[model samples]
Target: MLKLMSLEIRKHKLTGLIKGVLIANLIILGFMVLVLFVDQNEQVSTFTSFGDVFEGLFVFVKAVFIIFASALLGRLVIEEYRSNTISLLFMYPIPRKKLLTAKLIIVFLFTFCTIIISDLVLGALLFWINHFLQIIPGQLTWILVKDELVKLGTGALYAAGIGLIPLYFGMRKKSISATIISSVVLVTLISGGFDQARLGNFAAISISLGLIGIAIAYVSIRKIETDDIT
Candidate 1:
């Protein structure tokens, strides 16, 4: 499992996805910082713990990540399915279960790790800017840091979690475009109703749903009859 994951991570670099996540956080944080900094509104916070800023940032990226995850996993599946690659792999006397497990673990952890890195960078950058002008008081303001981190972490996981659903769809469709669009539509419906409200317990539910989706995908892939194997 470790070797398989290491191989995929090395190939993809995961940096591109991390960059996407960071850019999204900053762009949205920019507007919020502007509003608070310019207007001097103490009540108006820069952190979008649950509102549109939180959810909105993922609006486009949500689907994009889904496609990425799907591609990350599906590419191998497709390779095995369409190109007769699985035979070489299967003939090695390696258990097919191990192969499937490795792929699923890599796909799941890759998404989680990307989110962790991106959120850490984003939270650091925004807090730096906020503290520079005393907007966020000082570096020792652990409360602000903690709050923001919690929100960002939660938001990120929620996204990465639900984001995997698209991979399943992508695997089914095997079409990049379809996976992308479908991912967007799914996120819209999931995160739509709780808009402008604190994610609260629903965030937990989202995480659960994400894990469930991943589990189902893993099992499905265990029996997946792809002819190619990357």
Candidate 2:
């Protein structure tokens, strides 16, 4: 199963997709930073702090991620069922839960890793620009780097939490198209709540909720049998 999974990944070139996403995110961040730099003044409005800048970028990028992922996963499930390849998936001796579990793991892990990589690139660019502009005049310190790393990692995890719903969609219904559409609608309606993630205690609550999303997806996947996959 693992080997087949690897083949599945290779066939799809999921890594390439992640790389494309990272590059796209970097491009978007670059444009945003350019705009902000042009608009900067002695009295910086909302964009005063490094945290605010980063958070603003995150909110924008994650909105794209959330919308695209929901539709992508929804379509992923829908296509599998529509194409009837799910029938082949059940041919192996593996339990249906294990198969679904593998797919869920692959999907969310890919989502999380891609997001983290994008943030890391964004952080690096931010620090470079700050240093170049002499905005943060000081020696390069490890603590600052560590803080950025933490934010990147934690922020990615939080984003992934919201994205895991795509896995649930794929698990419960094989129509990727429908799942993606529904996921997009849901994200649009609920994004306002998570948009406050930069505020106090929101990160912790978000991370906790992300774990819950994973748990729910696992439970949903476990309830079905191999035959039902068809």
Candidate 3:
């Protein structure tokens, strides 16, 4: 599987995506700074504490990378099928399922790892900025850091699974636009909320949606051999 993944990465020239991710992170950091600035101008505090800042960081990371995953999926899977280029891959000696699975794994791992690393880096940077600006009140304690780390890990795990949900829509229409748009809709639904209550904050809902994404991946791989690429 690793071998196939390596080949897929090279074959698709996915290294470019790494650069794209970096650029995206930088943009996000700028947005975070803007948010802090906005918070200062308002009478009500948008981020009352470090915990709230971390939560905002998670929401942004999750929403951005999930869309990134879908775009990757569109390029890796949906576009191939749409162009009938996947038929050439199926002719290779490797099993069709393995070929497809390798692509999905790349998307999943990329989404999961990027969110964790980006969150930590951005969180640290935000902390430093806050130190000078005094934008948010409260001391950053070890206990809070530890708790945020836990939240980051579990959130990344759930996001990795949720990232695959777009595959269901992508496969249905064999359209890259459909794939990305579906992901946007999914992210909005999860991240949207009334005040402090977000749908994604509910552990049960996250778990359920994540399971649905995983099941979609399984079914997609199972039917790969039978799918017509001609």
Candidate 4:
């Protein structure tokens, strides 16, 4: 599995995916900075805890990660089918199920790790900015860190897990545009509804989506078993 994942990583090294992720992170940082300039009378000005700040930032984080996952799915899965390169992959000695599993794992790990690290860095920077600029009126504390850390961990997994939904659609339709579009729609609907409906908790929403993604992944794996690679 590790070897297969390594092969997957090498396949994408020259595809500009890494560069795109970096650029996205920079954009996220800029968004965080803009939050600093929110008017004093704005709703954002009322945040008084690191938890609130993290939640606010996560809205953007979730959107960004969802888009990132879509791109990865398009490149890794849909492109293979469109270009007829997945047939070549099927020629390998590995079972079709194992091969597909490896690809899914790569997407999950890459998306999960990137979001966690980016969120941590963004959180730290927000804390620093708030400490000096008093933009959000929050003080960073060890307890706050501990609390947010748990949320960050779960959120990262949730983001990664949700990518499998697009993976399923991409594999089933073999359409790159379809995969990306589905992700965008899913993110907008889930995030927007969760916020407007005053859902139980973001974590619960993430978990629910994660479970759905897992189910889709399972169906995808079963699919490739009978799917024609040609």
Candidate 5:
């Protein structure tokens, strides 16, 4: 598994994937800053704890991470099939399932780590700015800190897991465009539901989507064995 994952990492080294991830993070940071400026009054009036600020940040993070996963899946999976490079990979001694598993694991880990880091960095930066600027009114108590940490960890996992749905779509269709487009549509619909339902919590919804992504991944791995490479 380590060897396969290493190989997968090397494959993506020159693919601009890392660059893209960095650019995405920067964009998110900029957007967060803009929101802080525009919603200063609202945040000051409504937010009572760190969790409140984290929740708002998470909404954007979740959406951006989903799109990031779709792009990675396109380059790593769909592009391979589209370019007929997967046939070349099949000629290797490695089992197709293991190869695919390595790729998926990389995707999950990459997405998971990126989200976690981004969340931490942005959360801290925002908190620091708030300390002096008083943009968001909240006390960073131990309880609030612990709760936000748990949320951040679980939220990253949820984003990574939900990403597999687009991976499954890309693998099934071998279409990069389909993978990206479907991901956008899925996130939009899910976000819309949350907006309308006013559930005020995304734990249940995220978990449900994560489960669906797992099921789709299982189907993808099973089908790959007999899937036509021609």
Candidate 6:
């Protein structure tokens, strides 16, 4: 699986996606900082506590990466099927299911690792900025750190699974636009709310949605051999 994933990465030149990820992180961080700075000058509390900051950061990170993962699915899976290049891949000595699973695994791990890393990095940068600028109130404590570590782990897992959800839509029609658009709608449904009352904040909702994505992947892999690549 690892060898196949590596081959897929090399064949697709996916290392280039790192630049896109970095740029996305920078944009998210900049927007966050700008919001805080503006709120500080207005004497308006944008985030009342460090927990709020963490939640806000995680929401942004998860939203971005979920969409990003859908794009990856489009490139690695749907595009191949759409272009009929997947027929060529089907001719390989590899088991069809194994090949498809490798692609899904790569997308999952990429989304998972990137979301966690980007959130941590951006959180640290925000803390450093707050230390000097005093943009947000309250002190960071060990308790907060411990709690957030748990949240971060669970949140990333949920997000990684949710990221795979778009594959179901894309595969239905072999349409990249459908994949990306479905992701956007999913993000809005999960992340949109007044004052941090997002659907994603609910553990039950996140878990259920994540499981749906995993199920989608499982079904896709199980049916790969019988699927008509033509």
Error of 5 at 4 (Å): 0.9
lDDT string for model 1 (10-88, tens) is 6446445557665655665675467546545655544333233323334333444544566665555444544556576
lDDT (10s digit) by residue, model 6, range 183-228:
9999999999977688998899999999999999999999888976
State the weakest 10-residue window (summed lDDT) of model 6.
Answer: 37-46
Question: Which residue segments of model 3 deviate by more than 4 Å?
Answer: none
Residue runs of model 1 more than 4 Å from their true location after superposition: 9-67, 79-84, 132-141, 147-158, 193-195, 198-201, 225-230
What are the Cα lDDT values of the candidates? 0.57, 0.63, 0.93, 0.78, 0.78, 0.93
Query: For model 5, what is the alpha-carbon lDDT of residue 148?
Result: 80
User: Whose TM-score is higher: candidate 1's or candidate 2's?
Assistant: 2
Q: Please name the candidate that would achieve the greatest lDDT relative to the true structure.
A: 6
Give the lDDT ranking, best first: 6, 3, 5, 4, 2, 1
Tens digits of per-residue lDDT for model 2 on 12-63?
5655665657667867777767756764753645565566566666666666
Could you report the Cα RMSD, in angstroms, for every candidate shown? 5.2, 3.7, 0.9, 2.2, 2.4, 1.1
RMSD of 6: 1.1
Tens-place lDDT per residue, model 3, 1-230, is 99999988998899998899999999999998898889888898788888988899899999999999999999999988877888888999999999999999999999999999999999999999887888877889999999999999999999999999999999997999999999999999999996569999999999899889999999999998887766
Query: Which pairs, if any, clash in model 4?
Result: none
TM-scores, in order shown? 0.65, 0.76, 0.97, 0.90, 0.90, 0.97
Which digits, one per residue and each the tens of the lDDT, describe model 4 over residues 148-183?
A: 788778877887888778876776678888899899
**Of the pair 2 and 5, which is ahead by TM-score?**
5
Residue 222 lDDT, candidate 3, scale 0-100: 98
Q: Ten-residue segment with the worst summed lDDT in candidate 3? A: 221-230
